[model samples]
Target: MKLYYHPLSGHSHRARLFLNLIGAQHELVEVDLMAGAHKKPEFLALNPFGQVPVLDDNGTVVTDSNAILVYVAKKLKLTDWLPDDPVASAAVQKWLSVAAGQIAYGPAAARLITVFGAGFKPEEVITRAHAVLAVIEAQLSGGSFMVAASPTVADVALYSYIARAPEGNVDLQAYPNVRAWLARIEALPGFVEFRKTPVGLAA
Candidate 1:
């Protein structure tokens, strides 16, 4: 399997984290987003959206970070990573949605402003980050993991951006539960650190 990704991308890190956790045999192919490599013709052929973190599992191409997580979990028959139970599955999907929506526009977007000079409003995105973090901190108050008693795709989906929220100037210090939760995920076997940016409060 080959993973086309940018090291600093949280979306790329999410997919890469799951692949590592599952002990999947894969090769990393760096896409030079700095050089606009992702926007080139050949790369766009792999994903019309021209994004990093596209997975090529023997020609079975999967794009989008969340979709890639689901695909790899299903392919490996890792029921624990993504349960088949209707309730569990729905719960996981809920957080995955959060990852795509709030997390993306919030912490991830804020980081884009600082790290990549993106045009999003910092105040707006940071507010959104805290709002989403509040919900997650509350949800994790009585549980060790997100959906189930153990780690799920939902956890993987949310982990990267949240862990690196500080890089976006979204402080993690206010939410102790969220901080603890990040620590727990870090202690998990096969866990990989998302490359940190030198900007933001955490830095």
Candidate 2:
């Protein structure tokens, strides 16, 4: 399997994290996003959407980060990371939606402003980040993870942006449960980190 990705993208990191957590052997193909490589024709053949983190398993391609996670989990039969039962599977799906929705517009958008010079309003996105964190903080109060005692693709989907929320100036200090959850995921075996941008490194 080959994962075509940009290093700074949280979506890319999501797929990479799950692959490592499950011990899936794969190659990382870095796309030069800063140079418009993702929008180029050759890369677009892999994903017409021109997105980072497109997974090519031999000839079968998977687009979207969360979709990649689901593909890998189902392909490997890693039921613990992605459960088989309907209720538990639904629970995992719920958080994956949150990861793509609130987590994207919230913390992820906020960070895009700082790290990528995105035009989103800083105050607005930061506020959105805190709002979602509050709910996540509440959800985690009852359990170690978003779905169950063990980490799942739900956890992987949410981990990258939330872990780096401070880069967007969205303080994690207010969310202790959220902080603890991040630590727990980091402590897991075969965990890979989402790369942090350096100060003044916006491109």
Q: Please tell me which predicted candidate would have the highest TM-score against the true structure.
A: 1
Query: In terms of TM-score, how similar is model 1 to the real structure?
Result: 0.98
Cα-lDDT of candidate 1: 0.94
Scored against the true structure, residue 161 in model 2 reaches a CA lDDT of 95
Task: Kindly give the number of clashing pairs for every candidate.
Answer: 0, 0
lDDT of each: 0.94, 0.93
Candidate 2 local lDDT, 136-160, one digit each (tens): 9999999999998899999999999
lDDT per residue, candidate 1, 8-113, as tens digits?
A: 9999999999999888999999999999999999999999999989999999999999999999889888999999999999999999999999999999999999
Candidate 2: Cα lDDT at 12: 96
Off by over 4 Å in 2: 200-203
lDDT of 2: 0.93
Q: Which sections of candidate 1 miss by over 4 Å?
A: none
